[model samples]
Target: MSATTTSPRISPVNPALATPTDLSSEGVAAIADQLRDLLADVFALYVKTKNFHWHMSGPHFRDSHLLLDEHSDQIFAMTDELAERARKIGGTTLRSIGDIARHQRLRDNDKEFVEPRTMLAELASDNQELTRSLRAAHAVCDEHQDVATTSLIENWIDETERRTWFLSEIAGPR
Candidate 1:
C-alpha cells in the first residue's frame, strides 16, 4: 500500500504577486498604530529635550545641557529604529511635527531662556510621556505577536523609564 502525504499551504506576502493574506493582519495593524503613536511621542520629546538643552540656565547649566543633548540624540535614534520597523512591516511611519503634536500627550513651552529647574521639570514630564507611549506600543506588539519588535521596544521603554525616574528625582519628588 502507498502512503499519502500532504503539503502545508504557503501564503504569499507580496501585495503585488498575489493577494496579501497576512495571518496576523489585525495584529500587524495594531502594532503599526502603536508604533506610529510611539514615534510621535519620541519625536516630540527629542525636539523638546534639544530645546531645553539649548536654553537651560543655572549653576548646573553645563552638566544639564550636555546630558539633555545626549538624551535627545538617543531618543532621536530610537525614533528612527521604530520608524524603520514600521516600514519593515509594510506600515508608514508618521514624521510631521503636526502629526506628532496631534498625537503627543506632552506639550512644549519653547522658552528662549528657561530656568534649569523648569527645563528639568519639562524633561521629566516628556520622559514620562515617552514611557507611556512605549508601554502602549509594547502592548500592541504583544497583540501582534511580533517578538522582534517587542524586544526592541522593551529596551527603549526601560531606558526611558529609568531616565524619567532620574529626572523626576531631580524635579524633587514630582
Candidate 2:
C-alpha cells in the first residue's frame, strides 16, 4: 500500500519578465527586435575583431593588435547594453550563440590567415555597415519615441564611425 504523490502544478510563463513601458506592444517589439539583431551583428564583429587581433602577424603587429583589442572591447561592451535596452523596453533578447547567429547579418571570418591590411579593411567595411544598421535602428526608435534608446544608439554610431575611421586610415584608402 504505497501512498500516491500528486505532481505540483507548474506555473505558466510569467508576464512580469515583460517590463512595462509607455510604448505600444508593436513599438516595443519592433525596437527590441531591431536591437537584438544589432546586438547579434555587434557580437559577430567583436569576435572577428578578436580573431584578427589574436592572429595578427606583420611588421606592424603591435599597433594592429592593440587597435583590434581596443575595438573588440568596445564592441563587446555594447552587447550587454543592447540586451538590457531590449529588456527594459519590454521585449526578449538573444538567449544563446545560436540566437545571435540567426539574427546576425554580419559574416564571420574563419580563414587561417588574413593580411594585416586586409583585416583592417574588412573591419572598416563591417563597421561602416554597422553604422548604417545603427542608423536604421535609430529611425525605429524615433518612430517609437524611444529617446533613451535613441541616445544610446547615437553614441554607438559615433563609436562605430570612429572605429571605421581608424581602420580606414590605417588601411590607407580602401
Candidate 3:
C-alpha cells in the first residue's frame, strides 16, 4: 500500500494590478507613480543625512550632527505616510531597497570624508530638489482630483521648504 500525498494550491495576487479605487485607475496610477518617485528620493535623502550625521567632524560637529539626525528622522517619517497614501489609493509602492534604488533620482554620496559645509550644502540642494518634485507631484494630484493626496502633498511641501530653510541658514556664508 502507498500513502497518498496532497498539496494545498495557492493563488498568486498582483498588488500592482488596478483595483476598485474611488479614484480612476488612470489617475491613481499617475499619482501613485509620482508618489513612488517622491518616496524614493525622500528615502535616499534620509540615508544620506544619517551618513553625514554619523561621520560628522568639525568645530560645529555637535550642532551639525544633532541637526542632521533630526532631519533624517523627519525624512524617514515621510516614507510611511507616502507608501500608505499610495496603497490607500489602490496603488502599489516600493517593496524593497532595490525598488527604491530603481525609483530614486537623488544622488548618493559615498565619500570617506565630506566637509561639514559640503554636507550642509549638499543636503540643502537635495531638499530644494525634493520641494520641486513635491510641487510636481502636487500638480498631478490636483489634475487627478485627489484631494486627500493633494492635502498631504501640501503639508509635505511646507515641511520640505522648512527643511530647506534650516539647511540654508546652517550653511550660510561662513
Candidate 4:
C-alpha cells in the first residue's frame, strides 16, 4: 500500500489580506512595487548601519557608535511603516530576507573591517541614494494621488537627509 500525498491548493490571489482601497488596481500595483523596493533598500541600509555600529573603533568610537545605533533604529522603524502602507493599499510585501535581497538596490558591505571614517562616508552615500529613492517613490504616490504615502515619504526624506548630513559631518574631509 502507498500513501497519497497532496499539496495544499492556494488561490492565485488572496482577497482576505487585500485591504480595501479607492485607488485603481494599476495605482495599487505601481505603489506596491515601489514600496517593496524602497523597503528592501531601507532594510539593507539598516543592516549595514548596524554592522558598522558593531564594528566601530576609533578615537571618536563612542560618538560614532551611538550615531550609527540611532541611525539603525530609525531605519529599522521604517520597515513596518512601509510594509503596512503597502498592505493598507491592497498589496503584499516581502516575505523573507531573500525576498529583500532580491528587491534591494543598495549594496552590502561584508568586509572584515571598515575604517570608522569610511563607514561613515559609505553610510552617508547610501542615505543620499535612499533620499533619491524616496523622492522617486513620492513621485509615484503623487501620480496615484496617494496623499498618505506621500506624507510618510516626505517625513522619511527629511530623516534620510538628516542622516546623510550627520554622517558627512562626522566623516569630515576624509
Candidate 5:
C-alpha cells in the first residue's frame, strides 16, 4: 500500500505540423487539399476498374479485361506521385483506405453484374469528371504559382483525356 505510481506525460500537438510551406503555406494548403481529393478519386477509379477487369465476361472479355487492367495500372501509378507531391510541399496526404473513401468524390459500382459496355461508359464518365477536376486543380496551382504541380497536372490531364477517349471508343455509339 506504500508503492508510489507515476503517470506518463503526454506531449501536446505541434502547431508547426500545420504551418505554411516555402511555397506560401496558404497556397500549398489549398493545392494540397485539391490534390488529396484528386488522389482519392483516382484510387476509387482504379479499384472500380480493377473490379470490372476481374469480373469481366462475354465475347469481348479478353480485350475489355486487358484494357481495364491497363487503365487501373495507369491510375494506380499516379497515387504515389500525388501523395509525394503533397508531402514535398509540406502538406498532409491520405494515410489509409478509409481516408481515401472519405475524400473520394467518385461513385463506386458494387453491382454483381455490370455489362461491359456499361462499365466502359461509367469509367469514361468518371475519367471525364476527373479531367475537369484536374483542370480546376491546375488553376489553383497556377494561382498559387505552384509550377511544379501545374506541370504534373498538365501531363495527368492529357493522360486522363486519352483514357477517356479510349473508353468512349470501347463504349461505342451511346
Candidate 6:
C-alpha cells in the first residue's frame, strides 16, 4: 500500500471543510484559490477594524470608540465564519498577517492615529470591499453547485452592505 498526502497549502486539508459534493481536482483547486482570497480579505478587514478602534480620535470620541469596538467585533466574527466555511469546503484558511498584507485590496492604516471621518471612511471602504468579495463568493458557490455556501455568502454580503450603508450615512451626505 502507498500513501500520499496533499499539499496543506492547497487547502481543505481538514475534514471539517469537506466539499459539499465531491469535486473534480480542478474544481477543488479553483474553489480553494477563491477561499484563500476571501480569507485574506476578511482577515484584513478584521485587522483594519481593530486598528481603527484603537487609533481613532476626535469629537465623537465616546460614540466612535464604542461603534468601532462593535464593528471590530463584527469583523472578528466574520473572520471565524470565513475560516470555518473554508474548512467546510475542504479549503484551508490563509490566516497570517503576512497573507492578509499580500492579498488585501484595502490600504493599511499606517498612521499612528486618524480623525473620526478618516476612520469612518476607511471602515466603509473596507466594508464595501468585503461586500464585493462576498458577492463574488456567492457566484463561485453557484458555479460549484454549492447552494449551502451560496446561501451563507449571500447573507454575509447583505450584512456587510447594511453596515457599509450605516457607516456611509454617518459620514454624511456626500
Best by TM-score: 4
For candidate 6, write residues 1-174 as lDDT tens digits.
Answer: 000112323533556545564765545555566666777777777777778778777777788788878877876777677677666656666757787677666667778767778778778878998787777666666776767677778777887888799788777655
Candidate that would win on lDDT: 4
Residue 6 lDDT (model 4): 17
lDDT tens digits by residue: candidate 2, 1-174: 001112212222149686878987777877877887899999999999999999999899999999999999999999999999988988878889998898899899999989989999999999999999999889888988999999999999999999999999999975
* Stretches > 4 Å off in candidate 5: 1-21
Model 2 reaches what TM-score against the true structure? 0.91
Q: Candidate 5 vs candidate 6: which has greater TM-score?
A: 5
- Give the number of colliding residue pairs in candidate 1: 0
TM-score head-to-head 3 vs 6, winner: 3
TM-score (C-alpha) between model 5 and the true structure: 0.88
Cα deviation at 86, candidate 3, in Å, is 0.5
Cα deviation of 148, candidate 6, in Å? 1.6
Model 4 misplacement above 4 A? 1-13
Models, CA RMSD each: 10.2, 10.8, 11.2, 8.9, 10.9, 6.4
With a 3 Å backbone cut-off (N, CA, C), the pairs that clash in candidate 3 are none
Please report, in order, the local distance difference test score of every candidate based on alpha carbons: 0.71, 0.87, 0.84, 0.88, 0.85, 0.69
| Tens digits of per-residue lDDT for model 4, 30-68 | 788888888999999999999999999989999999999
Candidate 1 segments exceeding 4 Å error: 1-23
54-102: candidate 5 lDDT, tens digit per residue:
9898899999999999999999999999988987877777889998898
Candidate 1 residue lDDT tens string, 1-174: 000111112222346422232526555556666777678778778888888877777777887878888888888889879877876765555757787776666677755677777778778888877776677667667766778888998899788987787777776755
